[model samples]
Structures are given as structure tokens and as C-alpha cells.
Target chain A: MTFKLFSEHLLIVVAAEVLALAVGLPLGVLCYFSPKARKPILWVVDVLQTIPALALLGIIMVLAGAGKQTVIIGIALYSLLPIVQNTNLGLLQVDPGVKEAACGMGMGRMYRLIHVEFPLAFPVVFTGVRIAAVNAVGSAVFAAFVGGGGIGTAIYKAIRIQNMNMLMQGTATLMAIAIALDLSMGWVEARIKRGHSSMKKAPARRN
Target chain B: MIKFEHVSKKFGKKQVLDDMNFEIPDGQFVVLIGLSGCGKTTTLKMINRLIEPDEGRIYIDGKDIEKVDKVELRRQIGYVIQQIGLFPNMTVAENICVVPKLLKYDKESRDRIVHEMLDMVNMPYDEYAHKYPSEMSGGQQQRIGVLRAFAASPPIVLMDEPFGALDPMTRETLQDEIKKLQKKLNKTIVFVTHDMGEALKLADTIIFMEDGKIVQMAPPETMLENPANDNIRRFLGKHMNDDAVTLTVEDFMRTNIITVDKHRGVRECTERMARTGVDTLLVVDESDKYIGTVSIKDIRLRGKNEKLIEALITDNAKTVRRDGDAHECFDHLLNSGDNYVVVLNNDDTIAGIVTKNSMAKALSDTLWGDER
Candidate 1:
């Protein structure tokens, strides 16, 4: 029964994160190219972050009605800040010398953006996604507030009936899931960092 | 061939390229040099149309650059930047083949070019081909950066202070390598730099710019001999090598001296020394190219009627070319404390020797010619 509850929680987190990444990536890239759009888009996402996660889900429930869709949409909206900010930051932070070199080599703008700029920026951008994923796992427990089943159901029930045994079981399982998600993402981050360092020859020597 | 006619460009209020007009002919190694922000780099960018002119036009091979596609134009011309920015993600071979791959060359040809370019710089393909940029030292990476530009075998190449980041020793080695490669490839190269030493060493023609205008465009030796104005004189600096007075090995070399075969007997060598009234006899092989020298003192000490002249040869021969810069040869002669230095033709055959007598003759000729 505890295993089933953790799996439901994992599914909700994964669903919300995938949705956030898909929507946030293009929006971030758009902000990257069009500075005019960047300010307003980032402002809206900032406002979204300020709202309490439960309040934001409650507000989302008014439109979509309470269910897994409401929970998924709330978690995804909350995850947008990190994904968008990182995507823009990563794109902007690519070494200017590398960009100049690509231009001098006769690479067209589109080709350079896709092949050169994006790949160089991928690791920094991925960091944002990792942060969002970990945050989503923590927030997904709120799904039980709207009757979207997960480990939150077990915890809320244990608390109401005053059963310390069930409360510890649910709490312990949630911590384990968070640790597992954090550790796995950390491993992915390490892999990207390794690839990043190996890709460059030593920094150019200066006179 | 590149011709820029009355081109002008302004960045904000500053005129970066002003009425730049010149023609660089085919297969010439031209160097553009000036202070920072003086538009030497701007002129190079105009050729590839990276920075379009505000007015006038540029022509490449009788065709207007404005009419050609920018991507197509750049693909045909090679470019190198000051930073030697080799992509870290790529292997040495992959970086070199970027251009050729873009041009849609077959796999075999691209691979062959990768090996050929690496071999030109003494970097073996088996060792360097698969190594990442991060795996190599800065000098090695810059060498590959240079080789990448030459990979596609473009007709023209432009370099903007490509070796500027390297130490003096590495910069010099790369400079020599570039000179050799340019000669071997016969490609027209336009290199930009702030370094006067590099300009003098590599350029067939040096275009000196100031205030977004070319102050003078002349060969290195000519520019050194005659600066067009005070600004040019100041810009050339007070480098010890170049001055108003020109001197070469040809100006102080003696053609009349003893010549003897290595097979010739010591008695014959001694006779030639006496006949020429000289202390030394140049010994030559069958090719008539100098191999060593025999001295009167040596002949006296080891003289034998049956022994060949080669036996007395001390292997003390030192050679300098007729067209070699005089100051360097003069210092070599002074430091060695030797009275004679063999002057050789380009083919390495002995032309004559530069000795104290020849220096005296040169002094006399300059003195007498001026008075007359």
C-alpha cells in the first residue's frame, strides 16, 4: 500500500516536470532572441512563483476543477521560473569568443544557434530543469488537497486519526523519494559537467 | 585578387574605415598593421563581407563582392582570429575538416586533407587526429587552428593577429611555419597584426594604417629605408635592425681568392696560396661547391707531398648568403673572431668570401663613389 502511494506521487512529479520543460524551453528561447518579450514573460513567471503553491493549485482548480489535471498544471506553473530563467541564462552565458568563431567559419545564424550555441548552453540549462524536477517532487504531495491520490492521502489520514505509525511510514517514504530524486539528478548533473570539461582543449595561452 | 575602392564605414560617430582604397594582387602575403581601433581588422572583414561598407564597393577577382552571397563568399575564403578559438568539443581532425565538410567533399578527400594539413606542421595524423582540443597545449592548438583554415585549400586566407596570444618563442616558430606554408600553398594571405617584427618577417607588402586610413603601403625593406612621414617613422620604432643605410653580404664580399680541389695535393694548395698571396685556400669537392678551407699555417704544420689537400682541411667553413641582412652576419663574424665567412649562392655553391679585405673595399667604394 505504501509502495503504491509513492508510485502515484512519482508519476505526478514526472508528469508536471515534463509539461513544464516542454512549455518553458521554447518560451525561454523566445525570450533569449527577443529582448522585448523577455521582460514581460519573466515578470509573469515571477508573479506565479510568489503565490503559495497550495493557493496556486486552489486557484488553478477554479478553472480546470479539482483532479490530477489541476495538480499537474499547478506543479508545472510553479516549475516554470527555474526552467525559463536557466534557459535564458544558459543561452546568454555562452562564451562570446566561441560565438564569434562560429560566425567567422561561415555558419549561418540558425545553424549556429542549433548546433553551437544550444549545445554549449545545455549543461547550464539542464541545471534549471534539475532544480525544477526536485522542487516538483516536493510540491506534488499537495495533490491530495484536491483529491488527487498520492502519499499525501496517507499522511493526511494518519494525522486525522492520530496514528503515529502510519504517519512515520508516509513521512519516511516521502523523504526517501526526495533523496532518490535528488541523488539521481545529481548524477545526471555530474555527467554533463564531465562532458563539458572534456570538450574544451586547455584555455588559450596568453602572451 | 582583392580590390577595395573608396570604401567608408562609421561606427556611431567614429569613422572606422575611411575611403579605404587599395588592390592586393594574387598570391601576395600582405600584412595590415596599426594601433588598436584603427580599422586594420575592419578592412579584412569587408573582404568577406562580415562588415559591409557604408559606401563604395569591394571586388574579388573582377566580381563585385556586394553581388556575391555572403555565405558563399566566406566559404571560399579562410579566416583566423586572434584567440585561436578551436572548438573544445571537437577532435583536431574534426575541427580541420569543418570547412571541407561544409563544402560537401567526399569522406576520402576530407580524411586525406586532415592528414595533409597535420603533416605540414609536423603533427602526425595518428597521434593528433583524434585528440580533443583540451588535450593539447596552447601552441599545439593554435597550430591546429591554423591548419583548419588551410584545410579546404581556399584561394585566399585572412588572419587577424592569429598568433598574438602565444609566447615569443612559440609565436616565432608559428611565424616561420606560416611563411613556409604560404610559400608552399601559394595562397594569397592577408594578415593583420600590431607587431612590427612579425610584419617585417612575413609580409611581402605591409599596409600601415592610422586613423582609419592607410598611411603607407610598401614592402618591408622599402618602408624601413624610407618612412613616408614622421608618424610612420615613429610607428616603425627604433628597432636596431632597420635604418636609412642598407647593407647586405653582397656589399662586402670578395670574389678573388684561392680555389683548390680536395683531391689536389698539399703542395698544389700551398702553391695556390702563394700565387694568390693569401693565407687561406678554399677546398671544394668535384661539384666545385666549398666543403672546407686549408690555411697556410695548417699546410706548414701538416704538409706532405703525397697527401691530398683534403687532409689539411680544418672543416672551419662558415657560410652566409649574399642577400642576408648585414648586421646579423657582421655580429656573427665579430663574435666568432673569424676573418672569413663564405658567401654562398641560393643553391649553396660558394660565391666568394666576406673578409676584412672585402669590408675595406666596401668602405672604399662607398667613400669614393660619394666623393665622385
Candidate 2:
């Protein structure tokens, strides 16, 4: 039962994060490139993030009916801010000289974005994704309140039966998973940073 | 060949470049020198269409630059900036091969050309081909910036203070290397610098700019000798001493001399020295060639009965070439950790001595003369 609960919990959070990234990254990149569209899009996202998390979940639960779909939608909305903000920040922060040099070398816009801008912006964007992922995993446990199914169900059961051990076990496992995910992401971030510094150093060595 | 005809550029209400007209002959090294905000950099960018002119046109080779596709035009010409602007994410080899890769050169050819360019820039292929920009010093980064510009072997190169960020020693060395490379490559070069000395050293012709206008365009020698107006004269003030400062060892050489042979006694040497009243005497070999110098103190330190030849000591004295200028002389004095240097002739013979006092006097004379 515990394994089933853990797997289900992991799957829902992963799905939510993946969905959020898919929607948010392109939006962020678009906002970065199109000066005209950025302000309006950012305003709308800002308003969306202002909604209380429980209020948003309760609103979605009423509108979509309680289940995995309702919880996923709620978590994905809550996860959008970090991913979008990060993607925009990352792309905008790319060195203008590097972009110009790339273009001056005859790289088209698409090629420059993929080869130059994206790699330079990767670490910053990854940071955003890390924040969003942790947030999504924590929020997924709350889905048990709407009958979405996960370790949250055990916590709910223990609460109704006045069983502290079951409650502690459920909460402890979620914390462990969150910590493990954070550590792994940190490892990946360091690897990305090392690769970036190495790339940054290449032209300097030639001189 | 590149020509700017009645070119003017304005940003909003402010005019940055005003009716500037100049022509650079094919295969010529033309340097633009002026103070900061002089539009020298703007002029370089205009040629590549990085900054558009408000009025008039720029011609490259024969056609109007505006008519040519900008990307294609830029790809055909090499552009270097002080910041280097090498793609930070690319390897040294990749940075060198950027344009070729853009032009769709095959992988094998690109790799070969990258290696060749690294060699051309004096960064050997084996040591630097795979290295990154961050591992190198400012000087190395600047050299790669130059190589990156020439990697595609463009017929023209535009440099905007390319070595400006380097230390003085590195800057001068790079300047010399680039001059040699320019002669060998014979590419049409448009170099922009704020340093008048750099322009004097490198330019075949100089364009003196002020507030985006070309005040004068002439050979460096002509510009130095005859500035057109007060503005032109003041612009070239720093470089006025360049000629006098660059004297070679040959210039200060004095051949006629009083000398003594190794067999001479201290009493006999003293008589010759008394007649000349010189502090030191040049000792000659049997062939009347230069051997060493003997001082009165050296003879006095030895007993009169001792053989003067055996008593005389030889010291390796510092020498400068006759062709060296005051700048070179000053550098030698500073580097030698000594008070004076003997200037030498082209034949490697003693010319004359340049004491610290002479160098100081020459510099002051030039400075005072320039003030008037």
C-alpha cells in the first residue's frame, strides 16, 4: 500500500511539473523576445499567482469536479510562476555581446537562441524548474483531500483514527522524497554550472 | 576599397557624425584616431551597417553597402572589438571557425582552417586549439579576437581599439605582431584607436576625427609634420614626440674616437686620457676593433708597476641601437635597472652614451616645444 501510494504521488507531481514547464517555458521565451507582449503577459501571470493556493484548489475542485484532473490543474497553475519567471530571466540575462557576436557570425535567430542563448541561460532556468518541482510535489499531497489518492490518504486516515504513528510515517516519507529530489537537482545544477564555466573559459585560453 | 561619402549620423536631436567623407585604398592600413566620443568607433560600425548612417552612403569595393545583404557583407569582412566578443560558449577552435561554419564549410576544411588560423595568430594549434577563452589572459583573448576576424580570410578587417584593454607591454607587442601580419596578408584594414601613438606606429594613413567629422586624412608622416588646423594640431599633440622618441642606436652613434691598446702602461694611458679629458677610454684589439673601456679609477686601483693590460678590467656595458627613439631609450633605462646606456651603431659598435639626464632633457624639450 505504501509503495503504491508513493508511486502514485511521484507520478502526479512529475506530470504536473512537466505540464507546467511545457506551458511556461515557451511563454517565457516569447515574453523575452517580444517587447510588445511581455508587459501584458506578465501582468496576467502576476494576477494568477496572487490567488491563495487553497482558494485556487477549492475553486478548481468545484469547477472540474474532485479527482486527479482537478488536483493536477490546481498544482500546474501554482507551478507556473517560478518556471515562467525563471525562463524569462534566464533568456534576458544572456550577454548582449555574445548574442551580437553569434549573429555577426551569420547565425540566424533560431540557431543563435538554441546554441548561444539557451546554453547560457540553462542554469538560471533550471533553478526555476527546481523551485516549481518541489512546490508541485508538496502540493500533490494535498490532492488526497479531493480523493486524488496518494500518501495524503494515509495521513487523512490516521487523523480520522487518531493514529499518530501513521501520520508521522506519511509525513516523514513525503519530507524524505522532497529532500532527495532537492539534492538530486542540486547535483544536476552543479554539473550544468561546471559545463558552463568550462565553455566560458575556452576562448580565453586561446589568447 | 571602402569609401564614406558625405556620411552623417544623428541620434534623435544630437548629431554624432557630421558630413564625414573619406576613402580607404585597397590593401591600406588606415587608422582613425581621436578622443573618446569622436565617432571613430561609429565610423567602423557604419561600414558594416551595425550602425546606420542618417544620410549618404558607404561603398565597399564598388557597390553601396546598403544594397548588399548585411549578414553576407559582415561575413565577408572581419570585425574585432576591444571586448573581444568571442562567443563565450564556444571553444577556441570553434570561435575561430565561426564564420566558416556559418558559410557552410565542410567539417574537415573548417577544422583544418581553425588550426591554420590559431597558428597564424601565433597560438600554436597543439597548445591552444582546444583551450577555452577563460583560461587565457587579456592579451591572449585580444589576439584570438584578431584571429577570429581574419579566420575567414576576409579581404577587409575592421578593428575598434582591439588592443586597448591590454597592458602597455602587451599592447606594443601585439601592435608589432599585427603590423607584420598586415604586411604579409595585405588586407584592407580600418583600425580605430584613441591612442595617437598607436595610430602613428601602425597607420599607413591617418584620419583625425572630432565630433564625428573627419578633420584631416593624410599619411601619418604628413599629418605629423603638417597638421591642418588648431584642432588637428592639438589632436596630434601626444604623438608629436613619437618621431624623436623612436630614435635607433644608429642615430646617436659616434665613430671617431681616442683609444688605447691592451699593452699600454697606466702612465701612458693617463697621458692619452689627460689629452682627451674623457672619464673612460675605449680599449682596442690589434685590428683596432672595440674591446672594452678603461676608467681612471681602474688604473689607480692597480699599482703603476703592474702591467696596465693585466690590470685593466672588461665589463659588459649596456648598448642601444642607433635607430632607437627616446621611448625605446627610456624603456631600456627602466628595464636595465641602470642609470645610463651606450647607444650602438648599425654595425653593433659603440655610438654614444644616453644618460638618464639626456632622456629627461629630451622629453622636457619636446613637451615645452609642443606647448607653443
Q: Chain B TM-score for each model?
A: 0.79, 0.69
Q: Who wins the DockQ comparison? A: 1
Q: DockQ for each candidate? A: 0.53, 0.25
Residue B10, candidate 2: alpha-carbon lDDT:
92
List, residue by residue over B175-239, the lDDT tens digit for candidate 1.
99999999999999999999888998899999999988999999988888888877777777864
Candidate 1 shows a clash count of 4
For model 1, residues A88-142, the per-residue Cα lDDT tens digits are: 9988977776777677778787777887788878888889988998888778889
Worst lDDT window (10 residues) for model 2 chain A?
A: A198-207
How many angstroms is residue A116 displaced in model 1 relative to the true structure, after the best TM-score fit?
2.2
Global lDDT of each candidate: 0.86, 0.80
TM-score of each: 0.84, 0.76
Q: Kindly report which residue stretches of model 2 are placed more than 4 angstroms away from their true locations once superposed.
A: A58-66, A145-147, A197-207, B241-372
Per-residue lDDT tens digits of candidate 2, residues A1-207? 289899988988888888888888888888898988888877777787889777887898899998888778878887788888888999998867677666655677777888789879999999999988887778887888887888888888999998999999998999988999999999999999888776665332222
Q: In terms of docking quality, how is candidate 2 classified? A: acceptable
Regions of model 1 farther than 4 Å from truth: A201-204, B240-243, B254-256, B259-266, B273-352, B355-372
TM-score of chain A of each: 0.93, 0.91
